[model samples]
Target chain A: MTLLKVEGLRSGYGEVQVLQGLDLTVDAGEIVVVLGANGAGKTTTLRALSGMIPAKGSVQFDGAEVIGRKPEDLVRRGIAHVPQGRGTFPELTVDENLQVGGFTQSAADTAADAERWYEVFPRLAERRDQLAGSMSGGEQQMLAIARALMSRPRLLLLDEPSLGLAPLITRDVFERITEVNQELGTTVLVVEQNANLALKIADRGYVLATGSIVASGTAEELSSDDSVRRAYLGV
Target chain B: MQLFVQRVFDGLQAGAIYAILALAIVIVFRASGMLNIAQGEIAMFTTFIAWNLFDVGLPWWASSVASLVIGFLVGAVLYRLLIVRLGGGHASPLAVVMVTIGLFLMLNDGAAVIWGTTAKPVPRIFGTGRVEIFGAGVAVQVLGLLAVLGVLVVVFGLLFQRTKLGLALRAVTSNQESAALAGIKVTTVLMIGWGLAGAIGSVAGSFTASGNFAVDRNMMQIVLIYAFAAATLGGFDSPLGAVLGGLIIGLVSELVVGYVAIVGPDLRLLPGFALVIIVLLVRPQGMFGSPKVVRA
Candidate 1:
């Protein structure tokens, strides 16, 4: 039932260790969110999983070992990552940004895929030709997610999707995450600092401290747990 | 009046050479963010190779074409083996740049060892002809200049506009870390960018050979200064700007040398360098680059 498995993962920039023995997983058709504060290795965990950093661990996606593989190859294996800050290709049009997501797809096939995603996100469709940078933070985030989906990945990695947006925009992005989950059955792995909202939507969740997971449980259990409520969810 | 038009046309033909080298500089800059002071040196090295191949019984066309292929491989392999390692994050910025400057010397001296130092004749690709229009005579070389410029436009336009490779290269330029996250290979694309530009460098070298009508080891470095002026004048990443800037510098240089008899050929370098300073002073973004707004 597990689609991704991370075990004993350790990684870092030059001399600083950010992730040490990080273990986590996302089951098939599940939305698993990793909740943490800044410098808790949340982003580093995502980066390590995506193979952007040097790491010592095992990351198995759909039964294939992916720890040291190139990031582009990870996407080819049906794992799409929408990085933090919504790293949209600013100079390129919304549609062109989406096309970059589908880099591995045949040009002929991608043209067809674009029309389909346009139907799913109408605002993106309307602004298909507009530059990504001209849009609001929320819209750029939407485009980044839509762009990643263009690759038709089985597992979608959403890194800090709600970071730096207004509450309305945050709610909208969260709403869209559930929509994408229901509509496409995308197995989503989200990393967030907004524990309450993330836990509300995530079927299951993990808590990371520094670089290791301290806890894991169903959303309902984590919401009511004393430590979880005090440390995160700010209740 | 006829004399003025003729001077402009000849200036444009020469400007066309600067534009080619300038564009090569822009390509390498976009890929690695290095100014590549050695661009001209690499071109000169390859042009000498073409000349040697020609002397050894390869047809003029074969030798030139062969040089382009060799140039591409050399540019790519050189980057993979030397430049990229030096370009790694830990390397000092000045050290990397000075290494390229060192390459200029090594390639310059190296060429003499392989092909000797004397200048050589390159048989014309278009033969000889002249077309008169707008009160001026345009040699086939001038038309040939237009042809080469047109080819660069078409090729690079398609490269940045339509291909996945172009997308990957641009992505590498903007953010190498995020680009790696997206599964793009930074090293491969960087090498290709160098190789593609290297091949283009040979194209420019061939143009300088045939249009300028002689090729030599010293040619690329001299023209390199003008190409740098053009590249800097247009901003480092602006390909169209480099070409237009080159033509303007070329025309200005010719006008300065011709109309100002007191400043004749000996002082020709003055105007080109002056234009760069003026452009930099007026619009630091160069003539065509959009100002980048860096956010925290």
Candidate 2:
């Protein structure tokens, strides 16, 4: 069930190192939430794993050395990263963004894949022809997740899905994440500042301070931990 | 009054040609995110190839067709071999612009050596004829211009709307990192975009030869400035806008020459470029460009 394993992952921009000797793993079908403060190397971890940044690390995804590989290669290998701030192709139609999600698939399979996601996210289907930029932020976030899922990835990396959504929308998004995990058996590696909500859905959690993991345990354990409650949950 | 109607038709024909070249410039700009000063030079060189073919006793149609295909090959190869290596490392748009200007000189000098500086005839693709309109005759040349423009519009529209390749090209233009993450090949899209622009430029150049009755070393240079103005009037990325902008510039340029006696025929591009600057001042993103919105 060990789908991804990382050891001593070191990465950064220029000489300012961010992720120094970081280690992490996600077994198959597990939702692992990585909770961290702002500028705590959480985003860098997702970028490095998706090969968006240069890094020195041992990242084995399904038994392949995925480190230093191109971004497209990671996508083709079934690792989808829904970047922070909803990096949807705003100029493209909502449907076209989904089509881009399934870009690597054959013509015969792309339509069926597109149809499944469209059904699952019917708000997207209703605005299929609308330009992505014109959509509401929450809708764009939904499209971003749907677009990522079009690749049918077994491992989905989400960065700050609740950053700007309203409280009601945030709750709906969190609920949808649970549904996606149950229905698709997709393993999710989520980085978020919303520790309370993230821990509610995640099986296990890792608490990162600065650029290192300060604590790690099951979500239930971390949720009850007094230090985690003070620092992250703010309870 | 009849003459005015005739002049309008003539202006539309000329506008259609300018639009093609404008579209080419916009395509190059949107893809590589650089303004290629050498666009006209590369286009001139390709038209010279068409001229050489025609001069060597090949049929006119055959030469023009062969030149377009050659232009596509050359543009694609140029990007793969030269342009791609520039890499975005410390390279500004101005730096790239200067390189293209250098390329312009190289191509111009290169063409002078290979084909000589003399003018050569590039025959019209459609044979000379006339169609009657309201008791007056319109040249087949005008119809030919409309026909070519129509085909280009349809093709480009389809390329933008229905195909995965178009989507990929757009992805690179919109966001390089996200496009790459989505499994879109950004580099390949860049090459294809350049090649398409080049091929269209060659067509415009050949039409230039046919319209002017001679092709020479400096053929594309004048047209290039006018094309820039047209692209500026339209949004930089809107192909349909480029054509529409071209038609307007051509007619207005003609009108400036025809109406105002003092600042006559010779100083045509001066006013045309001035118009573009004015248009840009009014709308930096151009007439059809979608405004960019950013989150706080």
Q: lDDT (0-100) at residue A12 of candidate 1?
A: 93
Report the TM-score of candidate 2, chain B only: 0.94
lDDT (C-alpha, whole model) for all candidates: 0.83, 0.84
Give the per-residue lDDT of model 2 (tens digit) for B136-163: 6788888887898899989988997778
RMSD (CA, Å), each prediction: 2.1, 2.3
- By lDDT, the best candidate is 2
Alpha carbon lDDT of residue B244, candidate 1? 88
**Any runs in candidate 1 off by more than 4 Å, and if so which?**
A232-235, B87-95, B134-136, B293-296
**Candidate 1 TM-score, true structure as reference:** 0.94
Q: Lowest lDDT 10-mer window, candidate 1 chain B? A: B87-96
Query: What is the per-residue lDDT of model 1 for residues A156-210, given as tens digits with 9 covering 90 to 100?
Result: 8889999988988899889988988998899999999988889989999998888
